[model samples]
Target: MRPTGVQPIPLASALGRIGLAGSGIRADLPLVSGITLDSRSVQHGDVYAALQGGTRHGADFAAAAVRSGAVAILTDEAGAELYAQAPAAAGSDVPVVVVPDPRRAVGPLAGVIFGTTDRDGAAPALFGVTGTNGKTTTTYFLDALLEALGRSTGLIGTIEIRAGREAIPSALTTPESPQVHSLLALMHERGIDAASMEVSSHALEFGRVDGVRFEVAGFTNLTQDHLDLHGTMEDYFAAKATLFTPERCRRAVVLVDDPWGRRLAAAAEVPVLRLRTEPADEGDDVADWTVADVEPSGLGHSFALVGVSGERLVLRCGLPGGFNVSNAALATIMVLASGVRLDELQHALDRHDPFTTEVPGRMQLVGEEPASIVDFAHNPDALERTLASVRRPGGRVISVFGATGQRDESKRAVMGAVGARLSDILIVTDDDPHDEDDAVIRRAVRQGAEAAVQEEELACEVLEIFPRGAAIDRAVARATPADTVIVAGRGHEVWQEVRGVDVPLDDRVELRAALTRYGFSVLSAPRIES
Candidate 1:
């Protein structure tokens, strides 16, 4: 048995059940001390899980783990066999637990050791937001709102993981179960009152979020994404729905603007707060919250929020784009439903300033001569919406986008089509060609753009630039004062993943250099969309 707190029993019990060639191990045998998957992070008394990978097996590092003071090992049967054959020093005094499937057990074991599930129910309220595109935006908006209301909050998302003053670079959109619980425990200890997290479908399907409870769950509209991993839209939707199920969350706040969200709202077991932007149709049932008389202007949007009690509140947002209005409304309703006082909402809204700052890569504008916009729009729907938003009078739209390698190749053409139909000039370039040929991915995106232009009967010039930086620079140099440049895909990512390695790249820095080279001044005013 592992020492209490040094390693929790749930993880210990799972480890103990593995038939090792040993007698009754003491509950405090001091065999295991900690758990880790990253070999570099292995510490004394840690059990390093050696998982099988595309190129190598974790068992190959058993000696290294043992040298780092790991008392036991948890791996699959093959790994166990390999461990059994190792030299006496490598296998000496260390127990090897042979689990049939080690990956599935990583989360549960992590939960037992570092998780806070056994703590009193006084854990801070947690809210989970999941969707393909708007998850990061909504999470940030929620964090801002919570913080404005004088609540100490923690945030976990694709951008970064912020807990009080400590900010760790995010490794995944959602952390693995052990890290998740460990972070939650840290937050709880630091006097955090609430937490807002972006839950990815991959996290749900892989049990990365197991042993964590959510007080409220939010859903934004879903579009084409991650089909390569999920295999089908149905499977993707099922994975997203897992967040709202009884096992994951206790209450649900769903946006009914998308058909899938409407369906999920109907299927959720917990209390559902249905939100919609458009008017209810004749056959449409009443929703918990509805927006009406939406007024969008250059300044921002002002709308009326009607609740189930027929109570109305005049709300104004400092964010542009019609989609942002919907996002803010959904977040507002979610915060309200979480038991925050309605009176406090006015102060929160008064202090709410969406345009004062912007999400790094989303709708970031560079250069003044021929304005350049950088956004993270890879899918057809997101690309279409973003292009439409940048359309201005007396200005032509120049689009620069590309598809990622090893992802759903089917969407390449769709993105291309949207760009060709909306842009005056199209530049197809590399996004992330992880382990795949960059040229192959660029061609796919170009094909999609060409097809869209043909279908729409529009004549647009399409250019292919292999290296993204050169393409963006050429587009910027060629643009006149009356043109707008849009750089799509890979928003807020600090590194570009190519051939299985992450290369340092920042879109904002590159765009600035391109603008300076073209003798154009960057805009100083804040023009960010949430």
Candidate 2:
């Protein structure tokens, strides 16, 4: 027998279960206790999943994995061949389990090894949200809703992974196949009743979400993003549509606020519950679930979601933007779809200060005197919403934003034009140049903003501040108490990716420092009780 929670499966049994081409697989292999793709994280009695990657092959590290106590080498056919020919084969009795498509195989393999195939009542209910924007906030809202209902929830997204209350920093929006299964198993063991995950387009395309099944998969609006990976909007939409397939998720809630979302709904095989943000916009029948009467006041917004049944529910959110209203509405429908009692969700919303629902670095107010707001609005759509949502009272909106390097360069000019249209003072700063020429990226955005100002005859003052911290300083120093400073891009990220190095540079922390320099503090403001 294995340990308490770990139920080890015989290597032969698991291989036969997944129906992979087991050409060179040994019949009498050891019972594997765990599975891992990373060689450094391998342990005794674990199956080392060697994969063929874009940049490098996992077979190259088979020796390290074996040395780290990997019992068997589970890899693709090519990887298996490489492992057999390599020096690691010498004196190694480990069986090389060959599979044609190891990427897809890993998910099922992980599911069997971890005992998550039986995602029944005892298992935590899974919720997955995917889109170009609002996925993070939507996941956060669903997690918060469950937490308010007195249920411990695990959260998985770009910022971090939380197994109940345990927070582990994460790299990808959806972690690797093995890690995802392991995290789900851990969440199950920890007594979490539900989990909310942000599924990225890259994750879908790369098969990161292969093995798991979501109880309710949600879609935020898709816009111009991740073009570098998908190459085109159609490909990106196709990648996102895979999540809504009947094989992937049981139910889905789609916000048909954009054309891409409408396309997703039309082709989705699974039963989909639709939602519309600007339901009263007329002409186009968006969705029966209409979000109307949106009032953005005092760092939060409240809206009524009228479902297809003509039932109306009013909910408030701390986050700004019509985009966030869509996120909140989608999250609500997801909660209801997950079979949570609707009254419980309503009670949670009614009793709790919905504004107190904490989403870090997303329209996060570091200082309220001059009203400093930091958001992870990287793309053109997000920037448009963030700039539009933030109000300046009697003063003007001073927006500090920049485009990221090596990703969807087409959006840079559009972002520049939108930023120019929204802000009275626009500062184009550096945001994660990541080995690409920072000057070139900044010039593209700045030129677009400058040209837009000239073309549209806008009075916005545009400036190029290479370093982000200086941009924060300049924006803060120029703004008064009535003015609002909206910092877009790189919201919750702790470090700024520059030249392949993640330097410690958090926008919220830097923005706070800038606010302190200007003699403004959040603590100095009056607090409102929910």
> Please, what are the lDDT tens digits per residue for candidate 1 over residues 1-530?
11233443433454454332234433443444467666666777677887886688888888788888777777888988877787854528777766677777776566556545553543468889998877877777788788878889998888788886677778799986666776776777677888889999989987778767788899998889899889898999999998887778888899888788888998888889999886666777688889987886553578888888987766776544566677777777888888888878866777765323465676666655677777888888888878887776898888888998888999998888888988999999999899999998888889887877777788888889868888888888888887888888988777889987988776666777788788788865323211
lDDT of 2 by residue, 1-530 (tens): 11248877898888788785367667798899888889989978899999988888999999999999999988877897788888768878887877778888888888878877668843588999999888888888888888877888999898788987778777788898888888888888888889999999988988888878999999998889899999988888899999998778999998887777777877899988878886444565557588878887556788787877777777987766667777888988888877877677788889875534768777777777788888989999888888888875687999998888988899999999999999999999999999999999999999999999999999999999968989999999998888999898988877888998978887777787788877887633332111
lDDT of each: 0.77, 0.84
Weakest ten-residue segment in model 1 by summed lDDT = 1-10
For model 1, what is the C-alpha lDDT against the true structure?
0.77
Off by over 4 Å in 1: 1-33, 88-91, 118-122, 279-282, 297-300, 354-357, 367-369, 523-530
Using Cα atoms with residue i matched to residue i, what is each candidate's TM-score against the true structure? 0.89, 0.95
Q: How far is 298's C-alpha from truth in model 2 (Å)?
A: 3.2
Q: How does model 1 score by TM-score?
A: 0.89
Superposed by TM-score, candidate 2 places the C-alpha of residue 273 at a distance from the truth, in angstroms, of: 1.1
